[model samples]
Target: MNRVKYIFFGILTFSVINLYPQINRVMGMGGLTYAITDIDYSLTPYNFGGNPAWIVVDEEETLLDITPNFQNSWGNYRRMYDSEGAINYGTAFKGVKRLSSKGTFVGFTSYNYEVVRNLYRTLRKDAYTGEAYYMIDTTQGDFRYTGPVVGLTYSWEMFNDLFIGVSGTYQITDGLKQVYTNAQSIFREVSINAGLAYRLSNDFVIASNIKYSDFQETIEAKDVNLLDVEVYNYKGDTYFIGKRGSSVTQKLNKKRFEYRGQVYVKPTEKLSFAIIGNIIPEIAKVLVPQNSLIDVEEVYTDFYTIDIQAKSQYQLFENTLLGLKVGYNNKNGWSNNSKKNLLMWDWNISDFYYGLGTSYKFDFIPMLIGAEFEISSIKADSSKYIDSRFTNVSASNNRIRVGAEYELFEDHFIRAGFNYGNDEVDVLYGGSDVKKLGVSAGFGFRLSSAIYVNANVQYRKVSTEYGGSLSRGGLSSFITLRLNTF
Candidate 1:
């Protein structure tokens, strides 16, 4: 009995944190293979997986295997379960280059600027409110924690044809929520990302990547008012039923890292197609069973996914181009995550994006170059998030971004862009729109004929309601260097 109370206390009071059953239909869905970026080689913080499956041996070499079970419903269904974190982001870099007649090539290509923040801050309000609550569960002692976080990302070319990258991040001192438990506590951990690509043809490429995320936070027991009374003649049941207040703290952590990929091909000189997909096998679902349970084991899962996209670009005239892209993703369903099917009849939520863009140049306008106009729709299903509050809603994200670059000097340049995505999701409470803006500038200096240096700076803003109450704004920054621009 003491042990169960202690565990519940650890879960509820442990951290300033932060999912779930569904049969994993995809293999290699829960490994750290995709979240990392090859923005630099100096540091490797994350990876996306496509590697041969192998059990990552722990201290005792206990072969950790997660299975799916639908039995959470009065033991009717049982599925493999475990905590799985999956993430991925990618962009196409198209550049027009200068190739010489002497069998020499020299040109520039601009890929999506993946500026993993060296570090960023997250300021929040309302982290400490509501409950007259005493500890129901965790390891980190009492007192809600809240503060800003610092994140870093590194990406660089690997094996000439591959790009490997990782992100390393930690928070200052937050009583944020825990990963596996609801308790409050201080949290710290690292995640990994990795990627690989092969140029299939002059106008085609295929890549696979993975990412990792692991966080741990501790919680402590809280004291609350109890019913002071004696029942009937049973003297043995005379113990205090008030809330528990213990100094002992408990730890709740999460290890979510998985891999996925994208494949691109050009069917014509101006037409391209791609397929993108990722996996999230198991999301942690905690049950106290009774007030006596101490700690619970995290369940992992297996799942699969499929995504396809098509894009086309056309030269509208000299220095002007137009592009269009469309896509669709489908999940066949997994056993553990099959509960997602519960809401399948209610709404469909799959990660998908489609858009059209146009760019024009003004080479004749004294440094007043061209600009680009783009509009896109990003749609998703909340059930896959493995949560109740996030379920029941078919969310659609709509966005628009306009970008321009101007040369300050012959070699130095300045650029800026603004984008916005409104949450078209159906939720129980609020939140539907988000405004965003991006500003960036870069410098290019030539030290010699063969070596050059490029440095860039970018700032991004996200404006919306902070908690349920206060309205706030979030910002992110990035810096990059291209030592050898081919």
Candidate 2:
């Protein structure tokens, strides 16, 4: 005999989830290199001083950078299953050209590209009872996204002792995912930035910037299916079989807006400080199966993220510099469906991080050295959720890095460095933790006064307390050449 059971399963569970450090020199130092100019302009859209001022008559410079990275990771989920020996590799390119002519106003354009850099996951569950009975249940999925970004910036002297700059960037990403169902998505991002720098005097300068960004993503899924079956023994030699079926289609959307501001001050030739703030508000909408399990309804989720950071640097001597950075990031989620007793829900996450760094240049040896140490305290809050009403979980991360650069000849360089870090994220996973260690070396050669080539190699390993480990070691090379109108 055969029996059929209809499982009113709502197919509404939608889940969604690297700058390599160093050119030739910083990779050897442990991947902790910091620059006020890169941090300010790259993150906040504020240019400290124009790369080339409005008055300078030197030819504009064009820069090219290429970076490729590889990683191998192994981990255990719920301590019940483990994925071992997974490898990931990706490559990124950036090119920037100054469009303004020599002895004229300054403007530039840039482009960035990345290839085949995405993630995939799978899950399967099965249950069966009785002799000669078997059941199979499985689901596999892939989330792939790639981006091409274009940016433009213009800077000119507004007046004597004052400067102004404006920049804009537009990015588009193609997102594709296939579970038991197939989905296609598109994401768009736009940013605009404006900044002003005023030199009150030679001893002091003030700079500030304001930036706005908009992000939107839409996803459509078709033909999602789920299956559950049971086989049991009847009386003597008779057997019975039972089966359930579920299928669905869904549409999901996410929209987010962000605003950022930064302020920088250099009160003296050797002292400088900067502060940055960011605020982001996000909304998510998705189609979910109704309680009866036959109809679909729309659900909304809201969340906000805020980040604040402060950094300061001091030149202790003519050849030595020291700096410190501190930051706090917070995320809060609110749910209005308080009455629904669901097994899974959303929670909030927060992280606080601080670090100290120092660099030194030897006047006599023609070499440079740098080092940094950092710590982060991470916490996950889910007390408001029904499943985690009683317990709170927390973790911490600690890291250290050191590197050095030596001039092998005039305009030629060689460098090497090593780093170690511990991510204590298993506080609730039987108190087991993960550790990371890596070492790297590289060399650079100047083909001409304006052309340079750099290459580097790194050996890295990640090991868990459950006897699972991952290793990634490979050779990566990139060339940087500049065009000048000298």
Candidate 3:
């Protein structure tokens, strides 16, 4: 009887219905559709200043979603100032609504709490720096961060063939160290994005987007112990100025602007293509408090970057899909010390990526399978004026992903995926010969006509050639409710 049942199930085809899944369905498929030219059931439209003018044309149903997630990781083969392990927990809320007949409104908010264990050196949120003009200490301790982020977006049809949209976001976080020298940090960021899309015809659309952002972070470290704390203020990778004090404070400020253009073409019902181009410029400044009335400028950096990508998707056969993607990025930056009238460092980096993916829906089974292969190359060059040192490095990385989804019964779906990757060298951590593996599983079920629940779990492991390993895990679940009024 069991053999008969298995044979019967194998003869029938299955389909997955989103009906309002918690996360994007593509994520369950190892993000195979990320570079696909289709926006339906995909989040590609939200990239690069969002080009949100397409929201009204892409989705019509109103939805409200709430998600709670937890993630944890432990690692010893990490960056110089990185944490040994960390825990992160967060919850998010999102809503979409149609305004009258011509406009769409989207709003989202999230809160997160993070615990970083055994962190060392720097007190910056992003430690991927030029190894210049930063303060560091030898003490290792734990840190806690709590933050809230909020955003709003609105899009509308301005004319028969023209659409416009705007969005704004604000984020603030507070971080504190648990051990001496005790440090406290406050970070804030605000950004705005605006875009316009014009439908030249039913088969072609063009869009342009612009974004601006401002960021600030302030850090203060103080020790209550009778002995003064000693720290190093770096001037370059190999040179530093040493200081001993009971208290130290620093501030960082940054501003960035971006411009993007996109063209989307659908020549036929089965073929679609998209191309995007972007330019960004940024400036950052670091300052150290010298006295009650004086603040010294430590370093200033200016950056320029350019990015371009193209993607295409074709429905080769009835149930077979193919996607191709290619992208390139280049960035150049220089850091200077105005007070000392010297150029500290100059850096340049370039990256190239190519990917191919395919998906097939089985005719005689209730399953859809997808696989993707990608390769990337990165090259970096740096020059330090103080030491007259020049260095150049290059690395290559390759990755493979496979995923499958099956329908167990009506309104019930299950998915599983696996990923593997190898990096000749880790650019950020300077690790040689890195290998990573990841596995994920997820399920979705409908509770009623308007409510649905979805959950997923993921695990990953990393190993380096020098006998160092790391393990990470995450779990996420969300409830989505929909309402229709017409």
Candidate 4:
């Protein structure tokens, strides 16, 4: 059997936040749910305050998946074992106004998490008499992820019908949790964003935004050969591979830019239509050099590209909105590793996703409810060097959101909501199914005509077959302040 698959997932699982630290990794419901199902609309709201009307909200922001998603990228902030529980936290907020020719806005966000949960890994080893038997589903140690982000943004109208905006940010992470080159590591990256918006006419507007980032990650690998698990033992003597998380595995110093343009038309006072297009540069990925792993000198690079989305939104009524999004994502990737040690294979992948949703505001209490459904197909080509374990992993998802916001007294507002979904994933060696639920509550205050503040708290839980055992969860709380001018 190829050690690539075994070693890859093994080492990769321990890799810090971003490498496995993904956009929605906590939603991986034991092959039952896809990471995409566990998504957050905002990172966290500590920098800005509440609003009677919040355009974004999600449950996973405070519910750590305890999977590689958060642990692989920014696992440093994790304060406890996530296997015993989880805490995913994040928020986003900004306020702006056209002050004659100059516009300015300030906002802040943060996302931190910690989760400890159980995993049922079906183990397989060649047995005597050429017989293969299943090993006991083992319970490994717990894991975690935590971090914070802060930023400021500004915009200026350069000319008639033209506008420019820029954003600067500072990020801090703790407990970086990825590993590459046989080492324990950490992950942290700082990035920038800018965008442009133009008015075609009184009834039309178009806009696009781009971002740049560079971060480091370090990885540390333990000598499993001496651990309690008999299955992982090798030679008696073991040495550390040094910390690779700072620059190995998932810790990528990326310089990618994603641009999107949208044109909105207001043909009449009551009806509005909008369409959007996206341009995503190729993804940049670099692997750990063998020289850093086992004293072997080698390095490699992998580049991939995709133009993943096309979407549209329409407003039938002033209080009702409809949205449709489709993605022709090509998770296709390339590889260029020349080292003849153990990490060389065809790194090709392609995946696609289709989604649709609608949101409405109820008149009674101004409640807002949105629901989305999606289907995905992510797969790889089988080759001698390719590990087909994950070939059959695929999934479908159905999401429903129910939320209500009401003005408590004038500009002050309160909100509460819930979310539910299911996902399935192909983990190469094995796959599982998952289901989850989220609960959230938030309040906002309009301090003045141009300033506002908001606070929110949320909790989430996931359930799946971990030897048919039930798992615990975590919670998150956030606050944000926003300033707007006219």
Candidate 5:
């Protein structure tokens, strides 16, 4: 009985968030530097916002970066609500500048366009909410989304051995479906973050950060064929009410808050370590339009998440470096019916990760090599109120990666990398028995004394088995140009 429950839980609560590839030159080397604690050699200045106060202490040079990227994927082995394929393309502009001896500023803006082909019954981007308050229909079609995002961050050394920073971002998107029951969607998001860091001594520093975000998505479906459109409003995993209409509208609103703290220690010039912890709380509400001015609340959900991680870096030798990382995360949430004032469903999930990596620079030649290994474990539990249905599940995954770079001559470099992973449970859709493989190659060129260019291309394949074997593959590429000014 427990095994059956676990299978169901895995099928219902699996999802993944797709993120754009980084535009840094180090990305060609399989991103090994991303896990290291050295701020001066990090991949991107934008990532410093994770500990916003680090902006003031970062010693990277001032520069402007322009990046253009594209990615595409297609497959048949997917979740019930997933799209058959997708294409994404975008461009971004980012900059970092030093205002004075004590102040630093960062800014970024980007535009993205996406096409989701042959999406299934779900009409919402997030279809796995335990509340089961989403809308669906029998028809499937392509959906298009386009949007622009803008953000700004500033850090200042407020006092001796103390630093403060603040950041804000805003994004808006518009989406439309191509076929009958042409659904239209509008999404808006806003976020703000603030943090402070203090140096307790020459060897230790502590930092804390707080963040808040608000999001809203409105979807409306309308048909011009003069035919009644059938829609299902789900109240649970297997139960839903049916309605026939020419048009319908719904809205989802979410608010979230996060608190984070970190401590960094440098006992010696050769070794450094950091420990970080985060807590997040979030709430979401589902509403249906009842009239021109009134809306009815259907479901309300409360969620909380906790995460902790430790990272360490050691210069094993004059030209060799070793890095280690360990992390754990837990998330739990519950949903209730607003009208009936009764609990509908609840779920909990936990994850653990371990990673080790090393890099070496050759003394006789202009070459660098790196290798990494990682392991992950996941567990989940869920319960539904109406049927008293409960489920529990667990899975594990392992990965290996290797990369190398060679300086062909002064100001020019070539890089290549390979990675493979095996999963007892698929990370994207929760299907069991999965294998993933990827290969990437890139080049970096110094166009002039103050300008540089970097480009990379990568291809990946995923194979999964449910009742039968299926495979999916995709290509992703990016080009970045940097202009440095003193």
Candidate 6:
């Protein structure tokens, strides 16, 4: 029971705000980064905001995107406990104008709102037989959290071949409730992006980009009722446990940098070569107090990470594409040692990842098929555990996806896909890994020449290799509408 309380607070302190655009079409392709050709919304070539130099517009245009998503899952505890669910709605606005022959300007903004809720259950395991059993469902009250995000970005060409961009974002979360606890959090971020692209000739183009960002987050929990829990261990002091309301505050700050270089060479009409390389580095610090009553009891954590990747793509027959990617990622962290906390530990983790992707379009019919496969090998320095218990620590996993689209009429399309993957960690009870399988179906319609809408639904399941699984999987659905103005 004490462990559960500690884990709950840890989640509230470490949960990071996600700001990436959730484009359903892109995710249907297994979230393949190396095979991405649509430069307008590709994060691999630039950063979170976008690449200023890559914006392409024939005339002045305004683009709008709206998406709503729903997700629910079970288990995967320590963060999202049992019966977890979320609903999110997001909208983005962008305006691009071709100012002159050598200059272009682009501006964009987006907002997202989400409602998250979950339930917790208690369980017991027999020591002699080592059999697990459930005691009570939702021993604690239902947990809920709500948040909203706002962001703006601007990019303009500074010179003949140089471009500059900047972005800012702010997020606030309210109504955060966990068991008998209530909390709130705030997040802020600012980033700058710069790039240079030069066209050597009509057949070739080379570009490079650099991005940097600073981020900060704060979480506060007040009037937390800790008296009813056994974790408080108040030394049998009834007055302090019953009358006092516990409070906690935590803060986190991070700085990040990224560099990307790309080259595209079109030697002939049916053949082309594309290559990209990326380097990313990040540093972060966290401050958390041991308890609310002690003013001087606190701990500090420092973390650092570095990542590098290279990808290449080849286009053949003008309608078929092949891509390959290789990458390495590493992270190291340390925290101040405290005697009161037995979980104080440091860690070093590293991994290697690789992937392959291919796609083809039939010339005789209006049909397209695409597939992607990826694998990751990870290693971590041994200890009780690092990050979270759900983390696989040292493991290898593989993922694969295939999707197809068919245009039955002039402006209507149908799409379908399937995916399978292995989880990062094995099942706790069975000691065997869990695998996931999913199927998706969707359609698209072109209302007009400038407006398009897409809707997709995915059904997924997670099951253990052996018997006696701990949880069920999730179901997700999303819809997107895009508007273009001339």
Which candidate leads in lDDT?
A: 5
lDDT of 3 by residue, 1-486 (tens): 121111111011112222233344555655566433234533233442257777777657787777776778786655556678778777777788888676999888888898988888877765554425656777888889999989888999899988888899999999998677677899999999998899999888889889999998888778867567776777665677777788778888889999988888889988877888899999888888788787777888888989998877788898888888789988877888868878977878788999998888889988888888999998877676765666676889999998888998887888888889997755555555778787877777787787776666767776775433443333433333433332
Sort order, lDDT high to low: 5, 3, 6, 2, 4, 1
**lDDT (C-alpha, whole model) for all candidates:** 0.33, 0.50, 0.73, 0.41, 0.77, 0.52
lDDT of 1 by residue, 72-126 (tens): 0011011011011111122112111222211111111111111111111111111
Pairing residues by index, what is the TM-score of model 1? 0.46
Give RMSD to native, each candidate: 16.1, 10.5, 9.7, 11.0, 3.0, 7.7
**Candidate 4 ranges with C-alpha deviation above 4 Å:** 1-100, 105-150, 172-186, 208-210, 219-255, 279-299, 310-313, 317-321, 341-343, 347-390, 407-409, 424-430, 445-453, 466-472, 481-486
Compose the digit string of candidate 4's lDDT tens values, residues 1-486.
Answer: 122223123211122223112222122211111111122221111111111011111111211111111221121211111233334544443333223334444444455564323312211111010001111212343334456666666565667767676676777555522211122335566767776667778676666667666655433343334332212211101211223122222233334555555555667754444554555554433334455444321323333446445444566566666655566644333333334333333334455776665666677774455555566665544222323332223345455555555677788877666677664632232223556577767777878776666555556665555334443354555555544432
Better of 1 and 5 by TM-score: 5
Candidate 1 residue-wise lDDT at 333: 28
Candidate 6, residues 1-486: lDDT per residue as tens digits?
Answer: 222222212211222222232346555544444454444333322432245455532223555556656655544432223335445555554455555554455555555555554544321110001011112222444444455555555555566544454445555444344544454455666677666666566566677778788776555545444532221211110111112235545555567787767766667754445556556666544444555553332333445666666566677557887777677877655443233343343555677898998888889999878887889886655222223432224678788888887899987878788888885543222223657687888778899888888777777776653434444566666676766754
Candidate 1: C-alpha lDDT: 0.33
Please give the clash total of every predicted structure, in order: 114, 4, 1, 91, 0, 0
Name every residue pair that clashes in candidate 2: 28-416, 28-417, 29-402, 29-403
> lDDT tens string, model 5, 1-486?
223332343234442222222334455666555333334444222242276776867635688888888889998766667788889899888888988776889888889899998988777765665454658887888889999999888998899988889889999999988677788888899999999889888778888899999999998888878677777878765778787788888899999999988888889988877788899999989988889899888889898999998777788998888988788999888888898998977878788999998888899999888888999998877687754777677889888888888999998999988889898865336566788888889999899989998888878888876656878888888888888973
- Given candidate 6, what's the lDDT at residue 271? 49
Worst 10 residues of 1 by lDDT: 17-26
Q: State, as a TM-score between 0 and 1, how close model 3 is to the true structure.
A: 0.88
Of the candidates shown, which would achieve the greatest TM-score relative to the real structure?
5
Preferred candidate (lDDT higher): 1 or 3: 3
Model 6 scores what on Cα lDDT? Answer: 0.52
lDDT of 4 at 347: 38
